[model samples]
Target: MSAIDDLADQLARDALDAAARLGDDRLIDDISKAIGASSPVSQEAFVSAVRIRQALARGRAVMDSRLTQAASQKAGPEKSGG
Candidate 1:
């Protein structure tokens, strides 16, 4: 992975660890309340991120299929003594 990906992965792991260590009912309640009170901009950003992820997944699937098809075509001629 790239350096940025490694850093982001580390940060996410650390954040999850910190959250797990809270182990407080009140803190969990407060976090739930805060999450339910997200602003419109944050909501929009979350939706946009979801959409982008979906688009990327679809693009990757298409690229993978195309690559597989190209490889099969290239191998077909070779196998046929072309």
Candidate 2:
């Protein structure tokens, strides 16, 4: 990857972390706007990285919830002895 791509990914990751840490996802959009102002190319790459990462995070959460629920389910009664 080019230096800009790496930098964009890093910036996107940091934005995600900060937004989550502050409990304000809107920060992602706000940061994106700022990035666009400085460098549209970087902003595009950064937005794409942010979106892909965000989707991954959501997918993981969904699968994790299902796995936890499945694991915690109670087993049915055993067959009775004759």
Candidate 3:
């Protein structure tokens, strides 16, 4: 990747990590806005990377949830004393 592309990717990753740590999901958007104001050239790439990562995270969560539910079902229901 070119320098700008590499930088954008790193910024996207760092922004996501920061957001997770700070418990503010808007951090990505805030970073994107800052980049747009200062370095418009890399803003698109950064935002794209952020979106791709978020989508991947969501997909993984869905897969994990489905597998967990399936396993619980296969294990059968719990029993209780009368």
Residue 22, candidate 2: C-alpha displacement in angstroms = 1.5
Candidate 3 segments exceeding 4 Å error: 77-82
**Model 3, 23: alpha-carbon shift in Å?**
1.6
Model 2, range 1-82, lDDT digits (tens) per residue?
A: 8999898899889988999899997998998899899899988999999988989999999999998887767454567899
**Residue pair clashes in candidate 1:** none
lDDT of each candidate versus the true structure: 0.53, 0.89, 0.90
The local lDDT score (0 to 100) that residue 24 gets in candidate 1 is 44
Give the C-alpha miss distance for residue 14 in model 2, angstroms. 0.9
Order of all candidates by lDDT, from best down to worst? 3, 2, 1
Which candidate has the top score in TM-score?
A: 2
Candidate 3 residue-wise lDDT at 50? 88
Candidate 1 lDDT by residue in tens digits, 1-82: 5554454445434444455697543543353345448654433343344345557768999999999999989878454455
- Tens-digit lDDT track of model 3 for 1-82: 8988888889888999999999998888888898899878889999988888889999999999999999999899778798
